[model samples]
Target: MNSFTQYIQQLFANEVGGLFAAEPAPLREARQKSMDFFLAHGLPTRKMENWRQCPIDGLVQSDYRMQREADPYRPVEEYFQCQVRNLATQMFPFLNGWFVHPDAPLTKSANGVITGSVAAAVKQCPELILPYLTTTHADKADRGLVALNEALFNDGLFIYIPANVKVEEPLQLVSMINTDDNLLINNHNVIVLGENASLSFVHCDDSIKYGKTLINNVTEVHLAPNAVMHYYKTENKDADSLLVNHLFVRQQENSEWVSNVVTFNAGYIHNAIHLDLDEPFAHANLYGLYLVDKSQVVDNQVFVAHNAPDCSSYQMYKGIADDSARANFNGHIVVRQDSQRTQAYQTNRNMALTDEAVVTTHPFLEIYADDVKCSHGATVGQLNEDAMFYLRSRGIGERTARMLLMYAFANEVTDKVTIDSLRERLANMVERRLSGELTLCDQCRLHTSDGKVLIFDVDPDKI
Candidate 1:
């Protein structure tokens, strides 16, 4: 390991050493094993094929320490309202990587539904928490960051739904990471769904303060036979935030996994999502959208592995870049030897608003089985000028017309945002960014559906 890697290890060893020390015997031992793995691999570099487009040279070159609070605690409610309050479900709140909800209560329903923190579940029912926590996939790559999180994570979320129980309301896990010190923030989460259960969950990650901090978060999900899950995640960290997110999903027979990934913040962001189709008749749909502007950079990598036959998986990602920002998408779809009759599709499309903007896309398909049907494609280009002019012909100004055309272009993907409120919220956020109200992109005036064009006068900071 280089000096920077060694420095990070030493810093973690000295500070925040007692956080994970109280965990159960198995988890505590797993934490140490992950730390040793990091010591051997260090951070990913350009030499690695997966890390080629999203190297961490600048991250390692800068000195970082484990973050700690220097003053009083601030609640995440101060920055964002509970928009999903009417959704009627369990809500878990985290501020600066710590769970602050005092009345955070979870109980089992007679129909077989259990929900609570892993720490709490372990005490009440160890059998419920044993099969899912650190179960099988330990991950051979990216152990450094995983180790970092396992060693430091204190607050986490755990949800369980019993057989035949369906949650009508969406479970919400809201997390806000802010630091008083220049250190990396790590978090771990676990969720389990029983057979024939249905669930929808949303995760929101934002920053409370502007500071140079690294965030590494991991969430493991397990779906039993005939179960269904819909997951939506949005991250809006500060421009100085360095974020790494890992999501793992394991699906049983006839299970479905639908997930959407959206990132509109952070100076440098890296996200990896892995889905394992462990049985036949599994279905998965993955969609992602990222908006990068100024000097910010966001990288997303996804892997879908088919271990059984008669499974289907679909992947689509879109990116919009402005100023000199960068966006990278690296997607891999793997079909095992026994995964015959598997059908998989993957595609990535990116648009650069300025010549200085940079976007790189790499879509790969690995089929070890001879009878599998898999296809993958990638495209990187600018907005279509013809489409912009076509809208302008009907009295729309240049700026307004461009916005309308771009909105329609992105809508092809946004329309698939199955959730009602989230889809509208994301569409408005994209519009605000396009209008330069967020300071993440250049200023632009837009026309409404009724043909009235207006320029936004309010400043993003003021709003």
Candidate 2:
């Protein structure tokens, strides 16, 4: 095995640590079970189907590190504080995989919404969380990295929206990593939305310090009958970090699940999203956008399973690569024989801003049902030379013209955010990444026509 693999093996050599250690009886048992699974399986490699394109060679070569016991830096505190003030929704903040403020106010009168650190929630409401805290490796059976996470994750946020409740505010879970120690860090989150409930969640991943660190994160989401869920994710880990995020979602009859994944910064990133439509009329809309610069590498693998009849799924992903960065988008849609009348569409579009930039797209559709509407396509090319020339003729500089064109290219996916504040935030993030700005204030401001500033609705569930 390579050095990365050996490093992971050594990190979780015998046991798991962090939040799982203090859990009560049953959960403690489950935690132990998950830990055992990880010690047996280990980290993923290029051989795994889901990880075929994004190899974990670099991550496995490093030692598993932990953040310092005390908070030595404050990179995201201002953002979280701003979110708390401007966002009308409930907010949960985690820094370096640990809950910084355990006493944050919760709008308890806001119906049946449960939001808190996954580990704390278990300690406080074990019975309420017992059923939903399993690892993503449940099916992979051999995913070593996921197992390792289950064994050693420090803190993760858990959210649940009960039946018929519509949360107006967007629930925000922000996770920040500080490379205090030089070992691997594992984090996990579990979210569940009950029947007819509508919920929106955003996960923001950022980091402080510069070191060779690894992040293995797993998230599980369940949408019950007629439920609606909207999810947005942003990853901006430092250049020396390696991040692996796995998301598993299940949808029931008439449920709607929408997801937007934005990867603007990272040294090496791999995102895996799986959606299982287990009941009739379930629908999934997936959109992804990635902007990579320098020598960064980003990979996305998504699988949508149509197991029931009359299900509809749509996927559109776009990538913009500059410098020597590389990106890969792989989309797989499968329609089973029992899933008649299934309608699925998948598309991947990529633009290489520089000659050295590279992108690979694979959109596949496998169908066993005769009466199904399934289509998949991918396109990889350079910026529209014609468009560039046309814009330049209007006095726009080459760099500015190219940035605008690139923004418009990614606008298709950003427009799907639905949440105005999120759209604005995502736009600013895109702009900042393209322009190499790390501070949000330096990012362009977005406002509606009425002059009412649109802040990311943190309490989306409250609305």
Candidate 3:
């Protein structure tokens, strides 16, 4: 066995029982199965088709501790602050790999929505949590990194919405990695919505410590018939951080699902998403945006499966890279033989700001049904020189003209966000990021370089 695989097995053998005693029996069994799978398959290498472009040799070779406790020197609340102005939200914080209750009491709504730590919910509502804990979208084949997550994840958020309920405000979950020690973190979350229910969820990832660390996170979402859900994810970690995030969704008849992934900074980051349209008339929309520079790498992999007739799916992703950065996008759509009258479309566009920047895109469609309509396209190029000259001719400065064009390119994905405040916040942040005025540690006070917090005014017209 490889050293990495042996190290993971030893870690699990040493602490699996003591660390996860609160989990239900079914969950424990799942963990054991996952451990076995990981040991057998080990980690993926360059030979694998899906992981060829993205390399993880350095990440796997490093020695990282499994953090189970928060750092005693720093308070967790020092890292939990709102980035969006005037946006009232129920917040839950996950530090390292464990859930930490916020300073303010978490809102308990009268609409029968339960939100708290996943381990606590497993003990309180085993019937509801056990059925879907690790059962939905179970893959029987080789899934190296996912199996590792199932075996090692300690705690994350759990949100349950009852039938016929609509949440008025957005629910936010902030996950932070702050420690002086080198660490590897594993976290898992579950979100379920009942029939005719609707909810908006925002997930954010940040870091305060400058040390190198690896974060592995997994989230599963289920929507009942006639339900609607909107999900938004933002990543703004330090340049030394490594991240792997997985998101899975299952939709019933007449349900609607929309998700957006916005990435600002990271050293090596990979995002994998899977959507299953299980019943008739279900629809899904997937969108993503990433900005990277200075040797940073970002990869986005998406899969959509049409299992029922009359279902639809759409995907759009845009990225910008400069100074030897790399960006990768791979989107796959499959229509089963029994599924008829399916509609799907995908598009990927990227801009390279420097000669050393690299961007790769692959959009694939596999159809076993005759009565399906699907299309996909991808483009990679620099900013339009003609348009730049046109704006320059009008007396606009070169730097301002370039920033304006880049902002216009990224605004296409930002404009699709339904939350008005969040959309405005993203627009402002993107403008600052493109102009090289934004710092990587803007949200955390401990890492601010100048000792004074920097804030930007939101301009709705810019978007």
Candidate 4:
């Protein structure tokens, strides 16, 4: 067994009971079950099909503390803040996997919405969130990493929207890491949108101190009939950070889920999403954009299950990898035998700016149903020579032209962002990232220069 696995076993036996001894019975039972599962499966290996291309060697080698005392000297806001301009959101702050706020840990809005820390919800309003808190989601299957998160998670964020209500402002979650020592952090988030409700949410992940840390995070979302949800995620960190994230989403009749994930920087990042369309006319639109340079690495794995007729799912992922960086995308769509009239499409495209940079894409479809329209495709190549030449001939510099093309390619996904202010902010960030301006920390140990904003105009007809 891996030393980390053995450590987990001993940790569970020694502290699992004590961790939740004060919590209610259901919470204890749920965590115990997850601990038991992890003991049996251990950490997922590269031999596993879903993990074959991703390596976890660096993750397990460290003897990180499972929990740590809250850092009194670390000022998180001094290190990182919301970069989205003019995006009005009810912001919640998380420092080192625990939600830190001056107000009550759990609060109810005037509009009958519950938003705050997940751990506080369990302690304060158990009856309100009990049904979904510790229960198994039908659309989700177990994974060793996700089990690890469930077994060890202490605090995160929770957002609940009651039936038939529309939230005016988006809710923003900032998951920030700034530590003086190497540590392990596990947290879970729960989002529940009731029938006929609609809301927009944004999640940001950033690192400030550049200390080595392993973040194992999980999120579960439940959408009732006719609900509409817009979700966005951003990750930017130094090279010393390792992140593993899992999301389980379920949609009911006539519901819609629109999600955009953009990764600007990270040392090692893995994002896995499991989506289930449980009723007819449900639709999911998933998009992602990533930029990696140096020796950085990123992996996005998505699975969409169509369980009802007339359900539709779409996925588009694009990334740029430079230097010796690596980017991987794996998307799988499954249409059940009973799910007739299912429509699913997936596309992955990447730009390998250098010969040493590697990008791998796998778009798969499994259709057990007879009446289904499904297609999957991937492209791995460099910048379009014709477009580059066109720009150069029009008196544009090579570097600026290159950024323009890359920006144009990325706009396809970011343009789909529903929130207006947030969309504009993302566009600016993308430009800065392509120009080498964006960094989570003021100065990354592996990085030297910061980025500046530059405008590149391209005539659509000429290009």
Best by TM-score: 3
Per-candidate total of colliding backbone pairs: 1, 23, 0, 1
Q: How does model 3 score by TM-score?
A: 0.93
Cα lDDT, model 2, residue 165: 93
TM-score of 4: 0.91
| Residue ranges of candidate 2 with Cα displaced over 4 Å | 1-29, 67-87, 104-110, 436-463
3 or 4, greater by TM-score: 3
- Compared with the true structure, what per-residue lDDT tens digits does model 2 show for residues 233-284? 8777667788888888999999999999998876899888989999999999
Query: Could you give candidate 4's per-residue lDDT for residues 351-463 as a string of tens digits?
Result: 99999998999888888999999988899999999999999999999999999999898888889898887787777778778878766523212111243322233222332
lDDT digits (tens) for residues 1-463 of candidate 1: 6876778677657643554444567766665666666777777767777678877655754466654432253343443445431245456766556555445435677767776555566557667775555353446665566666665555467788888888888887776554556656666788888899999988877665667777778888999999999998877767877888888899999999998887766588888898999999999999888877888889999999999999999998988888999899999999999999999999899889899998999888888999988888899887688877777888899888877766666666667777776676666666676666654211121122344433333332321
Worst 10 residues of 4 by lDDT: 441-450
By descending lDDT, how would the candidates be arranged?
Answer: 3, 4, 2, 1
Candidates sorted by TM-score, best first: 3, 4, 1, 2
Model 3, 168-195: lDDT tens per residue?
7899888877678778888888899999
